[model samples]
Target: MVDIRIPRLNTNDASYVLVEWLVDDGATVESGASVATVETSKSLEDLVSEHAGVLSRRLPAGADCRPGQVVAVLTPPSQASPPPVADPGRPEGGGTPEAAPVSPVAMVITAPARALMRQHGIDEQDLAALGRSLIRRSDVEALLAGPPAGVSPLVTPEATPAAREGGHARPAG
Candidate 1:
C-alpha cells in the first residue's frame, strides 16, 4: 500500500482544504497522472500520482487536511476493492475512470486561465502553436490581443464584441 501524503504548504500553515479530487477514490491510476487539485492561500496545485495503483481517497473534498497527512491510499491491483460511496464529482460512481482528454501541448492550466478559455470558447488545441505546456491567464490575454498570422482566432467576431463590452454572448434569436 502507498500512502499519499499532503505536502506542507508552508511552515506557517497547518492545514489546507482538499479542494477537488480529479480522480475518484479507489480508481486505478498511472504514475505521474494528476489525481487531485489542492489549494493554498497562495495558489492551486495538482496532486500527481507517483505510482500506478488503485487510489483510495482518505479525505473528502472540503475537508481540512494537515500537511503530510495521508490524503489517499493506493493498493496493488489484486488487493483493490470498490469504493464504498457514490462520488458525485465523478461520472461512473467509483474506480479509476479514464482521464479526461487533453491536448499534448496543454499543461494543467490555472483556474483563471480555464475560466478565460471557457468564456472565449478557446481550447488548448487553439494554443498549441504557442509552445507552452503550462498556460496562464496572461498568456490567454496576450493571445486574445493578437494571435500569430494563419492561426484562427479563438473567439467568434460576434462573441468578441460582447466580450470586449464586458457582456456575455447570446445565441442568435
Candidate 2:
C-alpha cells in the first residue's frame, strides 16, 4: 500500500482548509488526478493524486490538513509502494525548503486619486518616493496643492482674461 501523504503545496506559513473531496473512498485515481480541493488564505487549489491506483483510505472532507500529513493511502495495482522520482524538485532526502518569489508592492489609492493621477500623468512610484505617510486622495491633492515643478499655477476660466491680457507676460527676446 502506497502511503499518499498530503504534499506541501506551499511554504510553512501556508495552511490549507480542506474544502471538498472530488473522489470518494475506494475510487480509482490516475496519476496527477485531482482528489480534493483545498483553500488557503489567497486561493483555492486542487490536491492531485501522484500515483495511479485505488484510493484505499482517505481523510474526510472539511478536515484541516497540514503539510507533510498523510491524507490518503493508494494501493498500487502491482507494486506495494510507488517508486520515488529521481528529481522531485526538492532536496535529495526530500523536505529541504527553498525561498519563495517576492511579490510586487501595491499601494491602495482612492478612486478620485486614481483618476487625478491618470489625468496628470503622475507616476505613482515617483509619488510614493515623496515620503507621504499614506497614498490617499488627500496626498494627491497635496501634490497638486503646489504648482507643478516646471509649470505655472493653472488659471481658472474666470481669471484667464485678466491673466492673459495684463498678467506677467514674457518680455520680447
Candidate 3:
C-alpha cells in the first residue's frame, strides 16, 4: 500500500487544508493521477497517486492535514476491498454510493500546457484567445508569435523591443 501524504507547499509551513478528493473513495487510480486537491497559503495543488491501485480515503474533506501525514492509502487490485476503519474523520475503504467525482472545469488543461504557462508567464486570458478549451504547448507557441490584431498584447506596449522578442511583456505603469 502507498501512503498519500500532504506535500509541503512551502518551507515554513507544515499543514494545509484538504480541499477535496478529485477521485471518490475506493476508486481505482493510475500512477501520477491527481487524487485530491489541497490548499496552502500560497496556492492549491493536486495530491497525485504514486501507485496505481484502489484509493482509500483516510481523511474527510476540509480536514487539516500535515505534510508527511498519510491522508490516503492505495490497495492493490488483488486486495480489492479496503479494510474497515471506525475513525470518525476516516471513511471505510470502499466506493460510497452517494459520492461522485468532481467534474472538471471547461478550460481544464494538460500538464504540459501548465508547464508552458509557468515557463512563459502566459496567463489564462492569453490562452483563451486561442479559442480552444484545451490549452497545448503549440497553442501557447502560437500566442507567443504575438497577440492577434485588435487584441492587447500579453506584454506591455511600453516594453523594450528586446523584451517583446522573449515573449514576456511587462505591463506598463
Q: Could you tell which candidate, 2 or 3, scores higher by TM-score?
A: 3
In order, candidate lDDTs are: 0.72, 0.62, 0.71
Worst 10 residues of 3 by lDDT: 155-164
Cα lDDT of model 1 by residue, 82-166, tens digit:
5555456786765456668884532546566767777775667666656765566788778777766897765554445455577
Look at candidate 1 and tell me the lDDT of residue 26.
67
lDDT of 2 at 113: 60
lDDT of 2 by residue, 29-134 (tens): 8999998776554446788887788776566666677877788888776744453345556555565444478765445454456566655445565466555423
- Score residue 115 of candidate 1 by CA lDDT: 73
TM-score per model over all chains: 0.47, 0.42, 0.48
User: Which clashing pairs does model 2 show?
Assistant: none
How does model 2 score by TM-score? 0.42
Candidates in descending TM-score order: 3, 1, 2
What clash pairs does model 3 have? 155-169
